[model samples]
Target: MAGKRGGTAAKERLSRDVIVASALALADAEGLDALTIRRLATDHGVTPMALYWHFKDKDLLLDGVVERVLEGVEIPSYPAGSQPEWHVRLLDCFAALLNALNEHREVADLVHRRFLGSTAGLDIAEFAFAALQEGGFGRTERAEIGVQALHNLVVLVTMEPGERALRDSEEEVARRIREKKVVLQSLAPERYPNIIDCAESLVDKPADEGRYRGLGLDILIEGIRARAARQLAEPAEKAS
Candidate 1:
């Protein structure tokens, strides 16, 4: 029995990737506050020292989690000379990023802060930067747009309606949604007409989550497209 248990332990030897994957899963199921090295050690059936060997401290473990999330982004690629319009490619990039964040919404803020710190994050950024360049944004403009675009994508995930409701029982979620809709609709229509009209949408989950995210990406990409066009026209106007 002792030898059998020892062989099982040997097969389950810890690695950095395994530890980070476990940490991310824990963070997703529980909140980040519950993701402690001690808890991870307990989950892995090892001592805290085992986890510490992979992560020097909690901060490093958190960084590993951020890196793990960023690594999930699937940046689109096109064969040479066959790339679509810059806006289309840029939209695809942001969509991939949004999809990744949506999967692990609990770590959206952490990804926002530490995205550039990871190689995978940098790769995503490079894809965006290239698209922005093709769209005619200058160096300074690309820097600003890149930062703001990522921040807005993170906001889309973090502020998504009904995200928090997912943690509650179905009955509780339904009750809360009903209550919110009633409170919003109860407002004086004469002064709050729009609020009353949009009350249902405000309280209920979006019927199509993909469409909701796509709408946000469309708004972001259109704004960038408009700005890029204006920037391109500016030089011609100045020459005239």
Candidate 2:
């Protein structure tokens, strides 16, 4: 019995939690793509076979990492604080997610790969459902539109390429706008009257981060409300 007990202890020397935790740390330090079972085994000073006991392959290991990353995401109760009164709450939630993603950029790359139907995602889905209902959307159709809006924002921000690489930096933002303004101004007046007319608006001065975020939030939300109102006014058959 003592020998059997010792054998069991040796068998359980490492755990899935330990492997996942180590993998998360490695991904945080290096990028997610850099995380390999062999590298993990080397990090833990264990043989590759030991890791296989925990994760069958890299994809499984990545699933574990995604779980770990989301475990840290705090989805607040719908009425937790001075939010939920309006669209700001939703924008704040998205901004918070972006901030979190920026802090742990390795997870940012993996954000699109997350299960959209997971428990965490369900909270977002449910949150939008409730918000739309409160905003006068009925229990039935509002939930669907709410989901569409949420997904639009998520996919838009997530799929937008090159936050780190190009077309998105302090200097680059200014440079691109300047270049665009120059190109628009050089166009023939009659050939591109619209671009020439709106050149100043197109290259408007950049707002600070807070104001910029607020403006974007305001535009999207107000635009959604306008669309909803327009749909409500149309004939039932014509609305679609």
Which candidate gets the maximum TM-score versus the true structure?
A: 1
Model 1: what TM-score?
0.90
Please provide, for model 1 over 164-223, each residue's C-alpha lDDT reduced to its tens digit, 9 standing for 90 to 100.
Answer: 643578888888888898899999999999999988888787889889888999999999
Candidate 1 worst ten-residue window by lDDT:
3-12
Model 2: per-residue lDDT, tens digit, 52-146? 87788988888777666555666555555556564555555555554555455565556545635357655655665666665566666665665
Q: For each candidate, C-alpha RMSD in Å?
A: 2.9, 6.5
The parts of candidate 1 lying over 4 Å away from their true place are 1-12
User: In lDDT terms, how accurate is model 2?
Assistant: 0.64
Task: Tell me the RMSD of model 1 versus the true structure.
Answer: 2.9
Best by lDDT: 1
